[model samples]
Structures are given as structure tokens and as C-alpha cells.
Target chain A: MADPQGSNTRHQAYFRANLTLIGILLVIWAFVAFGCGIFLAPWLNQWRLPGTGYPLGFWFAQQGAIYVFVILIFVYVILMNRIDRRYGVDEKD
Target chain B: MTVQGWTFLIVGLSFTLYIAIAIITRARSTRDFYVAAKEVHPVANGMATAADWMSAASFIGMAGIISFLGADGAVYLMGWTGGYVLLALLLAPYLRKFGRFTVPDFIGDRYEARTARLVAVVCAIFISFTYVSGQMRGVGIVFSRFLEVDIALGVVIGMALVFFYAVLGGMKGITYTQVAQYCVLIFAFLVPAIFLSLMFADTALPQLGLGRLGDDGQSLLQRLDGLSTELGFGAYTEYGGSLINIAAITAALMLGTAGLPHVIIRFYTVRKVRDARSSAGWALLFIAILYTTAPAIAVFSRTNLLESVPETAYVESPEWLKTWEDVGLIAWDDRNGDGIITYAPGAAFAGKPIYAKDPETNEPLRGEFGQRLITNDSAGDHNELYVDRDIMVLANPEIAGLPDWVTALVAAGGLAAALSTAAGLLLVISSAVSHDLLKGAIMPNISEKRELLAARIAAGGAVVIAGLIGIWPPDYVAAIVAFAFGLAASSFFPAIVMGIFSTRMNGPGAISGMIAGIVFTTAYIIWFKFYDPSSNTPENWWFGISPEGIGVIGMLINFGVAIPVAALTRAPSPAIRTLVQDIRVPGDT
Candidate 1:
């Protein structure tokens, strides 16, 4: 029944960290999808990639963005687990 | 058996199997009904989630959208799948550890306010209904084309199937059935894609085959670009829209996927937080099988379609064109009675080319009567050939002259995909009404038995409404569904993340944020989607973001509003803080 004010501070820190990670991830996601896929597509098109006729940006927009997304999920899981443990809120069976 | 009989038998059998499974696995208790007694295996849960997430839109509409959009179609493939990564990393496991039956339960409990839960209920209903309407419409469209049934009758049949299991068996039943659906849908999607790839590129793997250019030794994309350019359309691989718009739309689709309630609720069905995390990874893997192949399906189908009918006169068009036309999918009009098909850009076809004269003697300029098959009728005259984008995937096997059974299988798969998602969304709506609204808000002391009854009633009622919408869908099923994503991202995602991770996000702040976000996003969509003049123009957009991309902006506003409000508001009670801490630490539970 003790006041959980101190724990609230800990929770707040965890929340902040999670939000920061989400923000970073979101920015990178936008960069890949919008930057490589659309905005920079013309610039990236100058360098011809081997095998495929598509420019680098076109590949990233269609295929690379998805690959990056899969990697991001794994990164989130690893980071969040550490965050959970650090906050002493790790789930136990 | 004939293709039609085979399709009916296979699809009917799958439906029968689904009902049998639902009956056998009907939940015995309220918890069992709502969250599968929280015992779903990570892999199984992942498969079920894939089925739940891939609706009629994914199966029927997505590839078609990609076919017309060309290289840009990658947006759907990447955006939809990438959201799972966001879900896995940013949301799922922690939410599961928070241990709630529905998404609103977590919001209400975390914020320590019934009002927050109610706000969540509104967002949930709005998002689910928008998404469900599209699925119902997809079902009707697919049935009308393949089964030759009336669209309204098709929607009713789909509604009845969803209502039967969703009301009777609840989450436990839905989870198991979805796993079966995932298998059926993936098989249905891949078999045709692979067959078409083989026909087009001599490679059975659709992904690699798509890269192979046709027999002229040109890359597939190069050939497609040439064909499209020849046909008076934009290049297949070229960018079309403003960079900002593309970026915004992609972001909206990704964030919206992360925000969807039905998707988030599936994670709660697992036994532990770890399972939720693992389940998301597995779900992405399952989804990737079809997601990766979808682009290839688009490429191969497009290549085959063009090659089969390019420059051919109406009388000489391929058999598949006539077949698809009978289904009202492909249409053509020979505006001029030129015995040959002419495909070229509008400007190139202004007048008859002086082909009768020698090239060395004749100038490039020509008279009004060109040898071109198309006329520049100022009204954006119809092309002699018109193909509905939705048919790209569904009609792919038939287009490539694959075996009859493969075509039938694709039909069954589309139904499975549509039905699974419809069931999942229906459950969300019903649970929100019965559990959150009835038991939690209106009748706090209601018995479990009474609550279950209410849940069933809600599920049945939702199916009927969704079916009605499906039969007579609004003109903007895709746009409305996009709006649903915006609402989910704006309202639920921010509140849930804050509630779990931020102890200071009190009831008042969370509730206010949810209300603000939902209201703003909904109003924005309504205004632009329904009210605004020149509604489709990007210039008419708010802050240069189209209605499609506004969801991401709305999410930021929700977080912006909620965090500051929480700082100014009084802290939550000690008891509520303890509950928050308790939910975060599974060992304490």
C-alpha cells in the first residue's frame, strides 16, 4: 500500500525512452520510405544498380523499405526488453 | 469438376470446417471468450494475426492498386508489413504485459478513468467499422465476379458466416479458425503467383521471375515501361506525385497499421508479454510470404496482360480479355474501325501518320486523321481497353492460362482472407460494446453470463450493419478505410503508449487527448473526404498533407496535447499508480 510516487518517476523515464526510440524509428522509417522511395529517387536513379534496371531509390522504396522494417521490429524488441528490465518491470512467469 | 463447382465445393467445405472448429472450441467463461483464456502460442497467435490483418482489401484490392500504380505499388507492400515491426517493437509486448481484454481496457485502467475508456470505445468503433465496410465490399465484389452471385446476396452470405462464429465462439473460436484461414489464403495467393511467374519468366519463384525481362532480353521493368509508354501511360518505374505527398501517405499507412485496434487486441490473446513480442515477429514472417509475392503478382500479371492483347484488334484480342470482360473486369471500345490495335500516347496520335509516304520524303507533322487507335476526345476519352485493377491478382491465374484448379483456389483464398479479417473486426466492435460499454460502464455489476449474452448480441448486430454497408458501400471504401487508420493512430496508439509507459498521464489528460485526436482526425477526414471543393487536389490539403497522410500528423497532435495536459493536471491517486506499476510488472501479477 506504500505510495508508488517513486515508481512513477521510474515509469516516466521508461516512457520517455520508449517515445524517443519510437521517434527515432519513425524518422528513419520516413527517410527510407519517403526519402529513398520518392524525394531522392531522381538523384538515386543516377547510379545504376547491378542486375535490376531500377535506380537505387526505386529499389529502396519498394523492397528496401520492407527489409528495413523487419530489422526495425527486432531492434524494438531488443531495446524494449532492456528498457523493461532496467525499469524493474520485466514480466515474470 | 468444373471450375465453378470446384470453387463452391472447396469454399463450402472450408466454411463447414470453420463452423465445426468454432463449435468445438466455444469459450466456457467470459475471459475465455474475450481473450482466448490468454493461452495462445506465439507461432499460432502469429498465424492467426496474419489472417486477421490481411482482409479483403489485401487479397482483392491491393495488387490491383499496385498494377495501376506500377512501381509505386510497393507502398502498400512495404507500408502494411512494416507496421508489424512497429507493433512488435513499440506496442505489442508491453500492452500484453499490461494484461487487458480489449485495447480500451488498458487505456481506461492506465488513465484511471472511465471517460478515457469511453473515448477509446468511440475510436475503436470508428476504426473497425471503416475497415470492416471495405472487407464486406470486397466480399461482395469477389463473389459477384467469381461465383456469379448478386452482390447483395454475396454480402449477406458473408455476413451470415461471420455472425455465426463470431457470436457463438468468440475469441477462442476466432483464433483457431484464423490459423486455418492463414494457411488457405497464403496457399491460394502463392500458387497463382508462382504459376504466372513461370509462364512469364520461366521461373517458378514470382519474386525472381518478376525481375526477368521478356524474351526480347529486356528487363521486366524495362519492357513494362516501354509497353506503358507505348500505350500513352506514364513509365512503369517513374515517380509521379510530389515527394511530400508520397512520404506522408506512406507514413500514414504505416502508423495507421500500428494503431489499428483489432490488430493490437490480438496480442492480448497470448499468455505472456514475451509471447506477444514473439507473436508479432511470427506474424510478419507469415505476412511476408504473400506480401513479398504481391508485387511480383502485379508485375507478372501486367506483363502477361499487355503481351496477350497489345496492339491487337478487338477481334484478335486474347481469350482471357473476353473472359474477364464477361465478368465486367476488362472493357474495350474500338473507337475507330481500324483493323489493327494502336497503343500510343495522346499527343502522338493527333492525326493519321503519313505512313503511305516514304519516311525520307515525308515530314513528321501529320493531318488530323492519324493511324492511332485512340482519339483525344477532350473529355479524357475512354481507352479501347479498360482493366479494373482489382482483377490483377484474382484473375492472374486465368490470365496466364494456369490450370483450372489454381484459379478456383484463388477464389477460395480471397474468401478466407476476407472472412477472417471481418470476424476479427466484428469481435472488436462487439467486445467494445459488451465488455467495455455494458459491463464496465453501464452495468458495472452485471454478471459474466449476462455480459456474454450482450457480447453475442453486439456481434450479431455489428455483422448486419457491416453487411449492409458492404452491399451498398460508399464511393470511398479505400479512403474511408484510410480514415479509420488515421483515427486509430491519432486516438488509440498515443494513449496506449503513454498510459503504459508514463505514470503521469492521468485520466483527464488521456481522455482529453483521445477525444481531441479522434475529433480532429474525424473532422479533417469528413471535411476533405466529403465536403471540400477540389477534394482530391493536394493543394487543398491541410498543412500540405493529404487526408491519407493526416493520421500521422494527428498522432503527433495527440501526443502533444496529452503530454502537456498530463504535466499540468493533478497526479493520479496512489492506488491507481500502484495499479499501473502492478500491470507493468508481470511477476507481481
Candidate 2:
């Protein structure tokens, strides 16, 4: 338990940072999957995608949401990696 | 070569590759057997995880279901892929950091209770068993259709192949073979899709082709919507199901995907916590390649099918319809005595077509139009055809008049998807029994060598049982799939999330929460699905959530019970709190 006080505070800060990032990402996730894909689909269907015939909401549900999900995970990976290093808690290997 | 010859050659060669990989990468120790000695590259592991996660349902059933349901099918597309987001963000990295051989290992140790471990083992085994039986049956179906063999014989052959690799090489064998399987399956799926896209929309990419306009100045989807309504069905782009049900079912599937023991166990094969996150990203990317294309195929195939079948003379209908009809997946009943086929939005028969057969010769009876004669009465509708949803993907190439080899490739791809998922589930079941139940409890003093032997025996036993179930498959395979996802969501997802995220969640709380969740969801499913299926209508549903979506409520109940119980009870020991904290960070231990 060397310097338990300082390390505990640092760990707390790191955990809070993680929670905030996760919170923001989850909000975006819910918005795309539930918000645009389902609830607002009818409203968004008023407009078609530019040059393509797909309604915006239908595209999100069928194709766009999945693309966003993939990008979201990769974004998480990159940001989490930076956070890991910033906290000096990254894997040492 | 003919389609049959091509199927045999390709499927045979794929099996040979898998066996060779298994022999080369066979496990030599418990670590290798359980986690591939934690040596798998993230990309390779990603491919394997994708192969393991995408079953015959995703490969064969999804596109067909989407073709039939149209926009309503977005539930599966979003539900299945969206789960990876939850897994990567919430569960995968932390579980990998804990360095466990199995999901039960983490649950039992984290809760510091044998009962908690036992509950986890039971949930894992039950879920995996239910899921694997379906995969084996899928393999058997592919063989029976393409290879012209008995379904039981196909299952036996599949069992023998799986037993060799799973029992001999364990996770190490399954992982590498799955990488090869992923390649084979994706290739098989994409080739026909690309060909169809070019023929229909002048685009090689099916995803873009779905949205492009045809010569008629209407997109494929617009034409589909028009055709569907003209045939008395809902528009193709409009979701037909209740919105609440769709949202709830999607939630259940997403949470269930993250909680699946077979899927989560794949993460343990990676070397570090970061690898877990990165591999999940890769896995979803690989899966998205097929998933995104499946809906495109659905739209294209549905448009093609509607355009070709309805109003066509039976004698002159495309050869694919007759081919599928010969196999009993397509049925034509000239309900109005008209020579032309008329499809609409109603059941062609009360259930499956009861084909009229020659009693003496025991062969199917044929009508004047050379269509198979059926004994069943029509449902007073103009619909003359009863089409099984599976033909969308299976017969897409044939419908589009693509080469016979493309059709053959679909068969091999279905088999790869089924076998890979089956192998992954069997491993989880075996590890739960041999590792958690036996080594962790019944025989704690057992040596690693004996443990490894026990695991192999358990896997062998699991394969045989799964094969038997596949041969004499229950009529409720589709219904039981709902049970697997529902139980996994209700029982494992909440418990595991609480165990990792909540420092105060104790053994009593977890055990009670799991029991409550599983019982509530199982009873609800049984009540609606088995006990009184006629009452399964939306009007009778509790809050309009179907049995498929009841897992969402069960999860809420789990959280409701767990947090309160944990609050009233004593806090977890300091060591456990520290353990939770340790898993949250990616650092050298």
C-alpha cells in the first residue's frame, strides 16, 4: 500500500473519466439505435437520403446504425487507449 | 461440375482444411485448451469470434426473415450488431483483465460463493445447449438439402468432425478453424450477392445497389413497397410490428449478445485487456460485412421473387421455384383453379401444405400444371404459394440465374456458420461442467491433466447429445431460440454487469437476482409459448411486449431485486472491492 492516498485519488479520477466517456458514448448509441431508428423513423421518413432513395430513418435502422456502431467501438478503443496511458494504467507489456 | 458435385467438393475441402488446422494447433495443456494459451492475435481472434457468434440463423435465417418482414426485420440487424457496442464498452476488457478461463470463474470468484458459481454454470450450460442444438440441426438441414443425404446422417458426420477437433484441440483447434471458417462463409455469402447487385442495380456493392434506381426510375425498395401493397401487404420500408415490441426485443438481443457465455469466452483468448477491446471491434466489423449485406440481399431477393412468381404461369415459372418446390420448401395450391399463380397476404394453407401422395407408390401427387398436389384445404385466400423464408438466401443465386456454383457455395457457407457456432457453444458447456462444476467444486484437488481429460470427455459427450437432438429435432427450435436469448439476458447479463460494476453486489443478492430473473422470464415464455399459445396475441400481452421481448422486463426485475437486496445486506469484503477496482483498469497486475 505504498502512497495509498495519492494512488487512490488518481484511480478515482481515472474511473470518473471512464464513466463520463462511457456515458457520452452510450447516449449516442441509444440515440441512433432507439431514437432515430425507431421513435423518429416516421418523422425522418419525410426526407430521403441525398441521391439515394432510402428514407433517412430506414437507412439508419437497416444499414447506417450498424456502421455507426462499428465506428463507435473503434472510437472507444482509441479514446480508451489514450485514457489508459494518461492515467499511467496502460498495459506494460 | 453439377451443383451437387460442387457442394460435395467445396464442403469436403473445407472440412479437410479444418481438420488439418486442428491437428496443427491441437491443445497441449489446460491453458491452450481453455484460452488458446492467450496467444491469439486480435484480428485472428476477431475473425474467430465473428465465426463463433454468427450462427446458421444469421447466415441463413436472417436474410429470409428480413425479406419476409421487410422493415420490421431491422430489429435483428440492429439487435445483433449493437450488442458488440455493449460488449466492447462494458464487459470484454474487464473480463479479460480478470484473466479467467470461463464466465462462471469470474462470477463465482467475484461473488465468493459456490452457489453463485453453480448458478452461472447452470445458466451457461442451459443456454449453450439450447443454442448448439439449433446449430447442429442447421448443419443437418444444409446437408440434407445440398448433399442429398439423410438429415440424421448429416448430423452424424457433423458430430464426428466437430468431436475430432473440439475434443482433440479444444479452444486452440476451434479458434484457428473458425478463422478459416469465417473466410469461407463470408466468401460464400458475398459472391452471389455481388452478382445479384450488378444484375439488378448496375452496382457491384449490394449495400449501394439496394438504394440505386432501376430502369423504371424507382429504387428496388420503392418497387418492393409498391409490389407488396399491390399484393395486399404493408409497404416494404414501413415497420409493421408494434414499436414497443421491436424496441424491447432489440434490447433483449443486444444485452443477450453481450451476456452470451460462448461469445464472452472468446475474449479470454487474447493476450491483454486492450486486445479484448480491439478484437471486439474487429469481430463486429467482420460480422457487419455480412450483416449489412443481408438486408440488401433481402430487398433484392424479395423484389426479384415478387416480380417473378406472382401472375406467372406455373408451367413457365422460373426453374428455381420448381426446384425449391420439389424439396417441399415451396408449395403451390391452385386455390381458384386458375393456371396462373396468385400470391397475397394470407396463409396458403392452414399450416404447412399437406401434400397429396399416391398411396401405393408413396410418391407425391402431381396436378395438371406439374405442380405437386396437396391434400390440405385453402384458407379462403387468393395466395397460391407457401414459401419458407429460408429460400431467400439459399435459392437467391438460382432465382437470379447465377451459376450453380454460387448456390453450392451458400450451402457450404451455411455449414461453416453452423459448425463454428456449434463448436463454440460446446466448448462453453464443457468448460462450465468440467471446470466450474467439477474442478471448482466436486473435485477441487484434481490435477490439470485430469481436468483436461475431463474437459475432452465432456466435450465429446456434448457433441453426441447435440447431434441426437439435431436428428430428432423438436418442433420448437425457433421458439426455444427465444428462450435462450431471454434467459441469457435476464439471468447472466444483469448478474455479470452488477458483479463487475457494483462493488456492493454480494452473493445473496446475485443468487436471488438470477433466480428471480430466470424464473420470471422462463415462466412467462412457457405460459405464452407452451401453456396457452392462443393467448400469445398482442392484445393479451402485458404492456404489449411479446414473449420475445419479456426479457427486458425480467432484466428490470433483476435490477430491482438485486440493488435492494444488496443495499439491505452487508457490503462485500474489502478484498472483493479491491478486485472490482483492479479489473476496471488495464494495468499489469
Candidate 3:
């Protein structure tokens, strides 16, 4: 079983790293979706986008946020694949 | 040929294509039936998943909602796509590594409790059934309108198509068929949208067209906002709902999207865990294509309705305007007897609108809303046009003066969206019954052949029930659908997340957390949705949380109950502990 105590410690460290990674991403998500999209939308609307006439908050809620969500998923995929390899758990294929 | 003949030809051809694909890829084993033998390419599965996920609501209903709801409609766009971030990160990869054919398989195995599994099963069936009923209803409506047949016959035709694909080829059949469906639907959606975008804004792309100034030198959205406020409705570009309601509603939809069994099951069809991760990105990319273009369609169609139909005397209205008016879907009262239709806010005018005329009776039928929906008010007639929201997508081509073929394509596209979702959902329901209920709980030693047989039978039975619900659609079907999303968010999401993330969560915690979430959320929905639907406004809401957002609270209560209950309970057994570690890693024997 590859030394129970040693593997257990290794597993805990891997788990903690994952949690930290996920925690950071989730905070970013909550900020863009809730903090910016809703609460700050009206306030941000005061400043019109330089090129686009849309208010900053309106832009964020409608288009900016979805683009960011896509970026976030890509980021997660790239980062987690790295993490998986580092932890020796990457997919075979 | 005529428009009706063209529509019949296109829709008929599309159904034939779907049926042929289903037969070509029929599933042999239980694995083939349930998870497509886990052999689908990530990108292809991504397309199939997109078709399955968009549903009639996304295709037929969303633009309609946006036409009326204005800025509030952004919630669906963000809510639907944003959920994929959660899914790709939180659930998909890990579930794929677990290598289960069904969601209940994961819950049952993870918690090491039959009851926990059963709860997940019940929630899966309930949510999928509610969702599928809406899809069936969508198909019936689309077919009936297109073919000019009885709605019930349309439903039967829809049911027969689903039975051949879903019950015959299972996931394998459904998968290939959905890829074809995605092509049909996206093409249908984009064509009318692109044409209108060019006509109005002169932009080639609908996405850019939405923000660009038209020939009149005003942005489409700006003009729409101006038009909306002039009629006393909220501004189109401005956010509509309260901040808290928007926050909660968006969160509920995101979490619910992530939790949906039909969507999650799609991940399992991919060959590797990595495919599961990347498939979500692709799925979102595909869905976002339609979702982003939808608002533009809404903006264009609403603006068109305002410009072309009105001002012209009813007798001189455009051909497309008369077409819808003939179907009793659009009505405006000429209260001033000027013979011109002036639509304004409902409360602005005292004139009541009546259905133009009953074809059979050659007399005006009572308007569907039955209150002279347009009323005899010339005072400030608030766009008193009773434009049925469902007609937005269906009628878009006609309104835009597009070719008849494009209109026919939209008809086929709507059918594709509804059929794909119905098939995906029926698969979930059947697996829940055959795999979870009969085999997992009742007959543990059932043969594989028998299980496969039971699955087909279960699927057929579910179609009948779902079709019946579609035919006699419940009074509050749409609201109940939102409630289904609520049920999913409150129950499966928390349970599955807890099981995977927390090694400390015992079966007891999982059980209690799910029960608490389901019971609380359901009671609130029942109270608001059934007991007193009239008082479902924010004031009557608990803490001003509307029923649409109540699931967020239910999710929190689940966490609240789970953490405490788990802390007090015995730790998960050592075997279960190792199972979690095993499930986390991919490419492990």
C-alpha cells in the first residue's frame, strides 16, 4: 500500500492545494457575478465605456461577465491539468 | 411552393434525419444505452450537450421573455453560461473519474447509504420530468402551429420521434442525433438574427449589431429603451429587478444548471476525465453562440413590431403582421376608430382589445386574456398589443421579411431543440427508474439483459406520462419549471459537492442535508406557487426573496444542516475514505 502514513500525508497536501486553488477561483467568480454584476452595476453605470456607450456595470453583467466566465473555465482547465500532473494523477490518454 | 408547404417539407425532412441517425447508432449493452459506451469525442459530445442543454426554453421561450422583460432577461444569459464554470471545475471531471453511468450511482456509492441514493433518484426524476414536460409541450406547440394540425396530434408525432431515438439507441442514438439537431437549431437561430441585424444596424454580426447605431444614427438598444419608457414600461437597457433578486435569481440558475442530471450525464459519455473538463468549455461556447444572439433577436423584433405594424392602418399592415393576427397571436384594438393600431402600455388606454375574428364564426372571439387585452383606451394606449411571447422566434422571419425557407428552417430548428432536450431528459428519467429504482434498490441481482430491457420499457412509459403532461400542460407549467431548477439546486448540488469535497461528511449528514434542503425549498415553493400565487410578490416573499430565488436559501440551509450534523456523526468508514481518494485520480486502474 506504499506506506500508509507517508501516502496519507501526501494526499492531505494535494487536497489542500486543490482547495486553495478552488477557493481563489470561487472568490473571483463571486466578485464578477455578484459584486460587479448586481451591487456595483448601478454605480458603475455612471461611467460610460470609452468605446462602447454601455455603462461599465451593464457591460460587465451582460457581456464582460460571460467572457470572463469562459476565461475562468479555460484557466481552471489549464491549471488543474497541471495540478493533476504534479500530483501524479493526470489522465492516461 | 407556399410558406406552409415549405415549412412542412423542412420540418418533415429534419425529423427523418434524426430518426435515421438514431437507427444507425443503436446501443447494444446497458452501458451503450446509458452512457454511450463512454466513447464520444469531447468536441462532438460538446455539440450534443449543447443541443440537449439549450431546450425549447432557450430556443423558443428566451427571446420571447427578453422581448418583454428587457434588461432582466440578461439573467438567463449569464445564469446559464456561468454555471458551466462551476460544472467544469466543481463536478464534471471528478464524476467522470468515478466512471459511473448515472448520477444516483455516484450518490449511492459515495454516501454508502441506500436512502441517500434514493433521495437523489427521486429528485433527478422529479426535475427531469418537469423539464421534459415543458419540452414536449414546446414540440406540440411548434408542430401544431407549423402543420396547422391539432395540438394533440403534434404531441403524438413528437413522442414517436423521441421513442425511436431515446428508447432505441439510448444515449448513443441520442448523442449523434443531437449533434445534427445542434446544427439545425443554431443555423435556424442565426439566419433570421443575422438578416435582421444587417437590415437594422448594417452590421454583419448580430453580436456587434446589437450595440451599433442604425441608419437613423441611434443605437438599437437606445431606441428600444426610449420606446419602452415612452410606453411606461421599464427602460430596455436598464436592469429591471431589484439587486438582491437579480443576485439570488442568477445564483439559483447557475447552480441549478450545474446540478441538472441530464447535463451532468453528458460528461460521462466522454472517453476521459480531461474531455469532461474541456467539454464544458466547448458546451458553453456552443450555447453562448445562441444565448448571445438571442437578445439581439429580441431587440430587433421588438423594434420591428413598433415600427412596421403600428402607424399603418390595420387594413394596410404588412403581410407578416396580418399572418400572426390571423392566428389570433397578435391583437390590437382600434379604440379611436381611426383604423390604425396604436399600442401603448396596458393601463394607458381604456380600450380593450379583442381577438380579430374567429375564422369559423366570422365574428371576433373573446381575446385570450378576455379583458380586451388592448382595452378601448386611447388615453395613452400602452402598447396594448397582445403579442403572444411564443411567437417571437416563430414569427421573426416573417416580421423581418426573410425568405420563406428561413421561416421553415426556424420551425425545424424549434422542433430540434425541443426533441433533443426531451430525449436527454427521458434518458435520465428512465435510468433513474430502471437503474436506480428497479435494479439498485428492488432487484439487486437482476441480469444485465433484464436491466436493459427495463430501461427501454421505462423510457417508453415515461414518454407517455411526459406526453400526457405536455397535452394537458399544468396551469403553472412555466413557474413549476423554475421550481424544478430550484429543486435541483437545493438538493443534488449540495449533496454531491459535500460528498466530493469533504471527507468528513458521513451518510447521515448527506441524508439530513438533502432532506432539509428539499423539504424547506418545496414548502416555500408550494406556499408561493400553489397556496397563494397571487401574493408571490416581493412583499409576500420571506426576506423579500421571490420564489425564483428561494433555492439559494434552501442551499444555505442544506450547508447549515450538513456541517453541524456531520461534525456530530461518526466519520465515513475507511473504505469510503479510500474510495474518495480513488475517485479523485484519473488514469488509475
- TM-score of model 3 (CA atoms): 0.94
Ranking by lDDT: 2, 3, 1
Ten contiguous residues minimizing lDDT sum, candidate 1 chain B: B347-356
lDDT of each: 0.78, 0.92, 0.85
Q: Candidate 3, which segments miss by more than 4 Å at Cα?
A: A1-7, B214-217, B309-312, B335-338, B347-383
Q: What does DockQ come to for candidate 2? A: 0.78
Q: Tell me, by DockQ, which candidate is best.
A: 2
Writing each residue's lDDT as its tens digit, candidate 2 over B1-589 gives 8999999888999999999999999999999999999999999999999999999999999999999988889999999999999999999999999998999999999999999998889989999999999999999899999999999999999999999999999999999999999999999999999998998889999999988877777788888889999988889898899899999999999988988999999999999999999999999999999999999999988888899889999999989889899999999999778889988888888888788889999999999999999888768876888999988898888877888788888999999999999999999989998999999999999999999999999999999999999999889888988898898899889998898889999988998998899999999999999999999999999989999888889999988898899889889999999999999888953
Tell how far residue B383 is off in model 2, in angstroms: 1.7
Candidate of highest TM-score = 2
Backbone collisions counted per model: 6, 0, 18
> Taking the tens digit of each residue's C-alpha lDDT, what string does model 1 give over B530-555?
78635768777877888877887888
Residue runs of model 2 more than 4 Å from their true location after superposition: none
The CA-based lDDT of model 2 is what? 0.92
